[model samples]
Target: MKVVVQRSKQASVTVEGRVTGEISFGLVVLVGITHEDTIQDVQFLAEKVAHLRIFEDEEGKMNRSLVDVGGEVLSISQFTLYGDCRKGRRPNFMQAAKPDEAKMLYEAFNEALRAKGIKVETGVFGAMMDVKLTNHGPVTLIIESKEN
Candidate 1:
């Protein structure tokens, strides 16, 4: 499991010219699932995302987690995170999980975040989505369950 976490002032996802999900003053999470991902990966990533201290406190220090700031989450499925570009000009996606399995894990990951009392929104899985966001501090971080 891999995730690109970005702090945002606001974010939204549009599919086929229709807004599917949106959030204000929160975190925008781009999630990816690989063949080896399991329930443990989902659990670990969800917990880490929720407790990540990217939001700034009163002293202008990044000391507050999403829970402390009462922020929302906009989760989007992005299998391309696993794209392997080491070879020729084209990238290979052999490491990405199949749609069926990936969707199941993706839903579970979002549900896990919701269980933590955070308002979670999501883009349609397997759909071509246009994501828009006002990145706060342009703060972005890549987290991988396998690596940790």
Candidate 2:
């Protein structure tokens, strides 16, 4: 499991010219699932994301977690995150999980976030989505289960 977390002032996902999911004052997550990912990976990533202290506090210090700020989450399934580009111009997605398994893990990850009392929105899995966001502080971080 891998996730690219971005702090966003606002974010939205559109599919076929229709808005599917949107949120404000929260984190935008681009999630990727590999063949080895399981519910345990989902649980760990969700917990880490919720408690990550990237949000700034009153003193302008990045000391507040998303839970403390009462922020929302916009989770997007992005199999492309696993694209391996070391060989050629075209990226290879062999590391990305098959759609069936990826979809299950993606849904479970979002559900895990919602269970933490956070308002979680999500993009349609396997859909071609257009995501828009105003990145707060342009703060971004990558989290991977193997690194934990």
Candidate 3:
């Protein structure tokens, strides 16, 4: 599992002119799953994102976690995160998990976040989506279960 986490002031995802998910003062998490991913990967990433201390505290230090800030999550299924571009100009998605398996792990990740007491929103899996966000502090991080 690979996740691109961005702190957003506000964010929304639109699928076919309809908004699927939206959030304010939270994180927009782009999630990618590989064939090797399992429930363990899902569990690790969800807990990490929930507790990441990317938000600022009263002293203007980045000391607050999503749980402390009462932030939400806009989770999007993003197989493109696994795009391998080491060869030629074309990116290969062979590392991305098949849709059926990816979807199950994706849902499980979201459930894990909810279990940690964070409100979560999501984009339509396998749908063409347009995501918009105002990145707070423009803070972004890429987390991978393979590294954990």
lDDT of 2 by residue, 97-133 (tens): 9999999999999999999999999889999999999
Off by over 4 Å in 3: none
Candidate 2 lDDT for residue 81: 94
lDDT ranking from best to worst? 3, 1, 2
Put down candidate 1 lDDT per residue, 77-136, tens digits, no spaces: 999999999999999999999999999999999999999999999999999999999999
- Please identify model 1 stretches exceeding 4 Å from their true place: none
Give the backbone clash total of model 1: 0
Candidate 3 lDDT over 1-148, as tens digits, reads 9999999999999999999999987999999999999999999999999999999999999999999999999999999999999999999999999999999999999999999999999999999999999999989999999964
In model 2, the Cα lDDT at residue 4 comes to 99
Model 3: how far residue 18 lies from native, Å = 0.3
Stretches of candidate 2 exceeding 4 Å from the true structure: none
**Candidate 2, TM-score vs. the true structure?**
0.98
